[model samples]
Target: MSTSSSSFPSSASSPPSSSSSSPSSVWLVAYMKLKFFTRIRRFLRSKAPHKRNRAASDHHAAEKPRIIDAVVDDDEEEKKDTDKSMVLQKSVKRLHFGTWEEKEMAAEQIQRLARDDVSAKKLIAELGVIPVLVSMVAADESGRRRAAIKALLELANGTYTNKALIVDAGLYTKLPKNIEEIDESTRQEFAELISSLCSLANTQSCPSSYEIISFLISILESKKSSIETKEVSLGALYKLSIVLENAGALISNGVVQTLLMLSLEKQLSEKALAILGHLVVTLMGKKAMEENQMVPERLIEIFTWEEKSKCQELSVYILMILAHQSSTQRAKMARAGIVPVLVKVSLLGSPLAQKRATKLLQWFKDERQAKMGPHSGPQTGRISIGSPCNPREAEEGKKMMKNLVKQSLYKNLEMITQRAASPSSSNLKSFAISTSSKSLPY
Candidate 1:
């Protein structure tokens, strides 16, 4: 077998060659395959550390963005916190600034802040600006005082808690003393502030209510006050009069007399009459109105005038309320000559006025009938004295009927006599006097 393998050729004896023709070719192929595998192994070995380093670098590159983002997020959060802290620090710093102008600006800022409920609460609770504002109000400088008032007014306009803060700060008591020193506009501002405070039902319990009532009354009664001051004061009083406790305070402050005096001024008459209507709601108010004859008297005159439609309407409305107080008030109104005016209003006034006037007229009629006892009616003008009623009441009703009849007759006679003495009679007397004077001159 060794001799045969050597003779034929070891490669040929090993296998039949369909692709390779020689041993060298086969050897070259084997050598190329080995070299390829060796180079592949070398390439793999050489690339291993690089691949690991590249993977690590890629991982670090991805993580770097996340780390930077975390840092950036932290930085932004710090910036936002810093901004909020800066705003708060600036507000506080400006609030206590040394310059009056700066302080006034701060106050104005506070005023603007007080307009919002959350900010107003912050101003009062967190910052405690109310006492600062009150000090500014009592400041010697008018500018500061005015600024402070505006701030306080805004503060009062906020939530009920803010209003309580203002009231507790003694703003109500301090404002009145500053009235004379301030301008008319400032005084009006004060009146508006009081009105705003009094508008809240919760503020009714505050002593400021009565104090404000008295302050406004004083303004109304002061002859030296401006018309604007008086007007705003009347407005404030009107607001305060709606509160039951304030009504007593108003009456005690002699607001009735002040309103009576104010009613005479044509510019102020309508508002004064409007406030008077509110005042007459309470018992003390009604009693005060009754005592002041000018109140009913002026109301009756306004109702009769018929020129000022609003004033006339308000006057009649007030008279209607007063007339309903009691039989005595009805009698007083009748004595004031409001009955005939009411009857005319019922006939010729506006729809609303007519309706109110008609009711009032009916009220008067019913009161008259009530006074005249069960037997009296519209047809029976006189009270029946011999009826089975209270003897004293019958006697009183009889006297009242007699006085009314006498007054009616006297008014009728005066009208007839005026009608008899006409323009023709006056012309004839003037001609005679002129002729006599001419003769004396010649």
Candidate 2:
């Protein structure tokens, strides 16, 4: 009834045995345990290697996308998507037809898009939007014209290749014509658009400039044009001069007389002076000629007309412009009787006219310089206004100054004259015609 005390051996260190502790049996048991464990280890290792490789492959695949796809995605679809965003949404979405505010916002957005130096350019190319913008400029609404002008200004900046296109589109002619019937605000918007276009046209140095100039001149000649339109027209003429200084366009356009007439208008005198001053300096060779250009005669004729019209500012400005011309031109101008008119201008004009007359007298003095050459002969003095008097000769000076001041050319001339005769007259030495040969510094 006794049981044998047997214990199961631990796997870590025990040897396998078939019978009781026999060496062979122990060896065999150990070998069997070893073989079983080796088989199990091989099975686990095989499966482990496959799992480890699969995991590594998956991890590498995920990590590989981060590097390779980064550049490829950027170079492919994503790049195109970035460009497509710039394409102007040409279809009139619901926003285009929304409430007044919404419509305004839409127009503003389009303008902002067109005004953006980068986006406008891309959108213009992508959406073919120039026609749309021209239509906007032609719109009856002032807000629309303002927005369209901004857009067109951006589009037209430094782009001369489109000048013919713009003109051919009849944008300029139509805008000015329509501006006449519009409200004042709308007219101003049109003016702004014209000014911007002029700025662009002035900078264009190509041969085709004459065409634009011609169009502007036509607009200027429109007798039905409003004063605002005329202002824009004259401004455009000034810009046209910048383009045509050497192009011989202004002379051919016969604009000098138009400018001369404009100068005579009391209301338009300032603007006319601005245009003539630039023309005097820029279009010197193009002055009226007996053969090719008769600009000198045309200009002198304006003085004659001014003298008749009693426009002293006009006379002074005309004289100033003549004074800047060549010696021959000045002599012709003087011979045309511009000098006496200016001398009268200096004497009769108010302080403003007198100041300009002072400069005109200075130009006359330079004209005398050109006349003082050794080969020059003693020319007959200008006697149209009575005997010319010299400095320091009191009685004769009194007579001549009287003749000069008697014209009373300006609206404010009487005020200036009274101011000159006041007890404080000594402070007004500039108004005095001194008898010294150098009495007039000019």
Candidate 3:
């Protein structure tokens, strides 16, 4: 085939007798070879376009899905002509009654199918496969547990129903007893899955028991745990803290101190402070936080964080709750030198944080004024703690005070008279003299 290069392929020089020498003919030949690829660019396709995302949702049509993936997918319909049954049925049965190897295989398959197949996810849960897979998570074999966890993670994605199912199956109680016992990879997988499921808390009655809290705390405290794992654990705990009822469980498990310690870490501080913000609202949470030695000072340290504005916001929020109606706690915060920090945050922090800091500053100011009333003033007289002599009696004390005042008045009048004029200016100089009548009654 000869060629030309004017706004066409070099092969366009070939005469218009059907030949594979041009770009257009090349695609046409490939389309002839394939089966269902009838349309040119897979758009405005009359019957079926390219099945771009074969998941539950399809954007080709309106919000209503064009054709179901599991029931009648493009790929399966062409290949499995005789076996028209859905793979979901076979997979559920095998997962339920299959042996060890079969169950693992079934989990892997379910994870794959349920990944993008939202329809298959609901179907798999409807077939009662979730509880079985959850049981597999507790299996002694590491591979079995990992497979089940991965499958459950897939099933829980964007589906509240599957998450509730996993929780109902006691997944909270199924966590590994010790984070150290499991390898790092499995621990991370567990954390990720738990973090996903923890979203179902508070809005519904998902049992966010202490077991889950302790498991997450273990992951957080683990030295071997990755930053990502700790972050996931922190997120789970934060979700659990949303419900006021879970405060006791979280507090009893000592999440307060751990969170207080972690909130100082700049990277992890924001999420950790968020959880503490939720907990600090409750009475018990307030008490627990107040008792921690790191409360106001450590939290005050967060305000100095000019970069992490969110952390500064949450830290100030917790401090406001701590100093709300409690006078003693405010005293402690005042002593911790939170006044300067709050002023800085009120000036520079986020708007919400600024408001909270302003409120706290007002409270501190009010309490300080109340404790020392308008008439109650600072000490002008020097009173030393190591002084051996005692204060004089009331009458003698009054006399001494009067004498001191009179002497001070005399000194002032004498200085004024001297600065008035020289003795040569007789009239004006004499008029400025400190006469006896100039000293008023003490």
Q: Of the candidates shown, which would achieve the greatest TM-score relative to the real structure?
A: 3
Error (Å) of candidate 2 at residue 205 is 7.4
The runs of at least 3 residues in candidate 2 whose Cα sits more than 4 Å from the true structure, single-residue gaps closed, are 1-127, 131-191, 201-208, 243-247, 282-286, 289-341, 344-442
Which lDDT tens digits does candidate 2 get at residues 1-442? 0010011123355432234676777767666555544443333233222323344445546477564555465455433432333223322221222344444455566555556545345334333345555656666667766665666666665555444345555575455443245555555455555565665554443333455556555555556556777787677666655653433666666666566666655566556556654454443423443222444454444444433443554445444444443466566666767655555555555555656655655565544444543333223344456655556454555655554444334314444433433232123223121122123322
TM-score preference between candidates 2 and 3, better one: 3
Worst 10 residues of 1 by lDDT: 427-436
Task: Kindly report which residue stretches of model 1 are placed more than 4 angstroms away from their true locations once superposed.
Answer: 1-88, 97-102, 112-125, 202-209, 223-231, 265-270, 305-310, 325-332, 363-442
Full ranking by TM-score:
3, 1, 2
- Return the lDDT, model 2, position 331: 67
TM-score of each: 0.58, 0.43, 0.66
Summarize candidate 1's per-residue lDDT along 1-442 as a digit string, tens digits: 1221122212222222323568777666455444433433343233222233334445556567665665566556555434433343344445543366777887776665556435434433345667778777767777788888888788776467667677778776675553455667777777777767766643544653566766777666665678887777776666666556667777777778878877878889999988776666566776788778686777777776566777876777666656554677777777778767776775666555665666676666656556655533234344465656677766777776776675565455444333333232211111112221222110
Q: What is the C-alpha lDDT of each candidate?
A: 0.61, 0.49, 0.70
lDDT score, candidate 1, position 437: 22
lDDT of 3 by residue, 189-256 (tens): 99899889888777664866778888999888888988888888898888888887889999999999
The model with the greatest lDDT is 3
Error of 2 at 68 (Å): 40
